[model samples]
Target: MGDTGLKRHGRDRRPGGNDVARLAGVSQKTVSRVFNNEPNVTTDTRERVLAAAQQLGYRPNGAARALLTGRTYRLGVVALGTSHFGPSSLLVALERAARSINYALSIANSFEDDPSGLAEAVDNLLAQGVDAIILSEPVDDGEEPLVVDVPVLTLGAAPVVHAPTVLSVRAAEGGDAAAAATRHLLDLGHRTVHHIAGPQRWWAARERLENWRHTLVAAGADVPEAAEGDWTAARGYEIGKVLARDPGVTAIFAANDEMAIGAIHALHEAGRPVPGEVSVVGFDDIPVAAHVWPPLTTVSSDNAELASVGLNYLVDYLNQPDSPPAPPPKHVHNLVIRDSTAHPPATEKGDTRA
Candidate 1:
């Protein structure tokens, strides 16, 4: 029992397949076959090899296997890194979908709206050798499309990457949703629907704004200048204050639920009752949308489904590179009518209800 050579070497050496084979009394090839799930090995032999691997704390080398197979089985995700509801929710769904397909996900955040930042992020992911890449929140930097060698999947309608393997899965058209919200307000006899728009750099925000304008024009409604917000309640509230003071502003549409909530707070502070005096609508029916005072009438997009469908398409491309590219599925949104919207105040019609 004096310092055995076996114990001394075991403490210092990293366990390998050879070590497991030695412990299991089998050839190294047999151990490798067992790990690789190749047929012809007896059940008992496989069990012994696995038990020996566990006892010795031996793990298969993924890098070695990847090199042999020429696939990393990893998906890289490029996101805006914002806490905004859409991007965050889509990321969660992407992770879950990747896991379900036995692939690993690596996420890199681009905090800036610069093309250089996006290029750097994509390069970083490529350096890590991901089999495929996903652009979760693609923004137009007013530059040429990004060039990538590997298969690329985008979660939105805009094509951010230009590659032979590029595929796009579209989310519900933001412009359509925005137009619906605006039309809802106008139909209620409001003169105009003011807008609290998200940052301009975001393609989603721009689409929402454009659609709002287009809808107003089509209906011959006044299109007031939109107030900009950074997708925050604070910014929404700041915009809200100005809107509340305007007696002609009887309806408002925010780009997201957080901004909508902030607008409601501003209206309350200004003694303007929601639905009674000013109706508010928002995009992205967030979880608290139904619980807020007066509740929120908003457009609900299936963000999780968008991620799942996009990831599945990427996986299909990975498995079948030669298959003719099929058309990407369209994501749809529904408008949820809640307590936050109503007809314009009756005071203008000389109908008073105390």
Candidate 2:
């Protein structure tokens, strides 16, 4: 009988340990070490073994290898199903970074508002034997972390269920930025700045709302009741039309770029002159941010950088499981001032109430 203790499944023709040893001209144990990436093998031997395995089309079975090394070498990402730019971009960045570090990724997109779906996605990733899970969803204050056997990482400011967390930016910093934008409008002498906020459940949205509120309050400007949207251009447009009609809204800070674009369109449709009558600011300086009639002034989340750092942190964690918990991932945010924002026009100076 063949030396492989496992039988090949139908049409699942992948070369195994024995096959790797035969090609590498070494014992199966040696091939096993090489495949596991264990240390102490001579460099020359490791190179030869890797070349031979590559030539023979040997692919390590993650499940079987997990049995041997106690690590799946697979990372899991739990993402939100919405096509919002931040979550989608973060997932793509994580996948690319995972590949860069020689790890495989398995992802599941969960609906942000569905608790059961989130639990199911977590269970599925665990079932596949992932080493850890990175959650891109904003933490649900009402929910507990899905009880899992693996480490869980939450990527936003909200308190996730007892899991390690990272944030895109400090809520305070985002608040500060919004306040600064408000101050900018204030300096330009607008009566006040109105907000088009994102979904209430999102940590980023909550934080931005808080900051915007604080800034307007500090500036002695009447902060209007914010309208909520799901961070879609369509929703932004809808709210934009409402804000456009008010005429008292001298300035606006959209929670994200797509919404900002929609808001701009709504302003045009309502016959309000942008910047001249209503200055606009947005968040997440996505590529389209600049393409709007006036290039957008917004913030950058450095999402790709966030992904790279998270993957590198996980790798380090894997290598040293005994180490104390790692510090939370650092989130960088910067303001990009472009053509979109300018001093509010002279007409709306006295009317702060909206």
Candidate 3:
């Protein structure tokens, strides 16, 4: 066995490439080529490398691989630190998609309240040498966009950063989802559909708000004032209480399922049976959407598909800069119709189509 005696640390340290090479009776460069799939190593050599790795419980060093290949093969994600369903779901999807392509994800959490946290998060990811940065659950602080050096992809919001390589998931999808939800209620004979919206600072929240309003205007229905919440069941309950007091409010649309469930509790407490007196609709058909008292009729996002498509575009931009970008995936803002929504009760005027 030939050994170059290339050691990065002490003998007692966790096994690294050097140890794998020594134990497998192969050169360090051969191990690198095998791990990198350079296509020159023999099948016997590859099998020995794997056997040695399994025996030594060794894992490939990302830093070492980056040094050898000149690419970190890491995807960086900048996301809000909240557990809000929409943002959290997309984050999980991004992790899955990145792993599917043999790439790793590094994440930096930014607080929604701290507007400057965006810059700091980007800086942290940049120091990590990620091939691309994904801005997930972006917020609108009314500040100018940050200038970034690497490729940027936005999962929910449109691109908020100025970068050499730019990619975006369906920016119109949120608004389109909102339109679908609103139209569904109006079509069911509701004179007017009230809204319980998330904070306007979030791009996702704003998208739902603006689109809901637009939908109302287009349907020629009376547009009621949108009530804002913190995307929690508690906040939804509070807003729902206010809407329940109004007899004219026959239908309600909450931005996310948490808020929607909260609103349902409020209406029930106020003696208004769901879809009996007040039809309700929610967004982000979460796991518990069906289990709730009355199943929630809400807009469902294909989070996994959205993440995979965005990652493909980012990888494409990195691999083939000269080629035109691939066409973005077409997603339908499909609404899940459940028992929570129905035709409004017949008043003296009766059920009228919008």
Candidate with best lDDT: 3
* Pairs with steric clashes in candidate 2: none
Q: List lDDT for all candidates, in order.
A: 0.83, 0.74, 0.84
- Using all chains and alpha carbons, the TM-scores for the candidates as numbered come to 0.78, 0.76, 0.81
- What are the RMSD figures for all models against the true structure? 7.0, 6.4, 5.5
lDDT of 1: 0.83
Better structure of 1 and 3 per TM-score: 3
The worst-scoring run of ten residues by lDDT in candidate 1 lies at 1-10
Model 3 weakest 10-residue run by lDDT: 1-10
By TM-score, how accurate is candidate 3?
0.81
On TM-score, the candidate that comes out on top is 3
Candidate 1 per-residue lDDT over residues 47-80, each given as its tens digit: 8988888788787777876887587878899888
**Candidate 1 backbone overlaps, count:** 0
Model 3 lDDT vs. the true structure? 0.84
Deviation from truth (RMSD, Å), model 3: 5.5
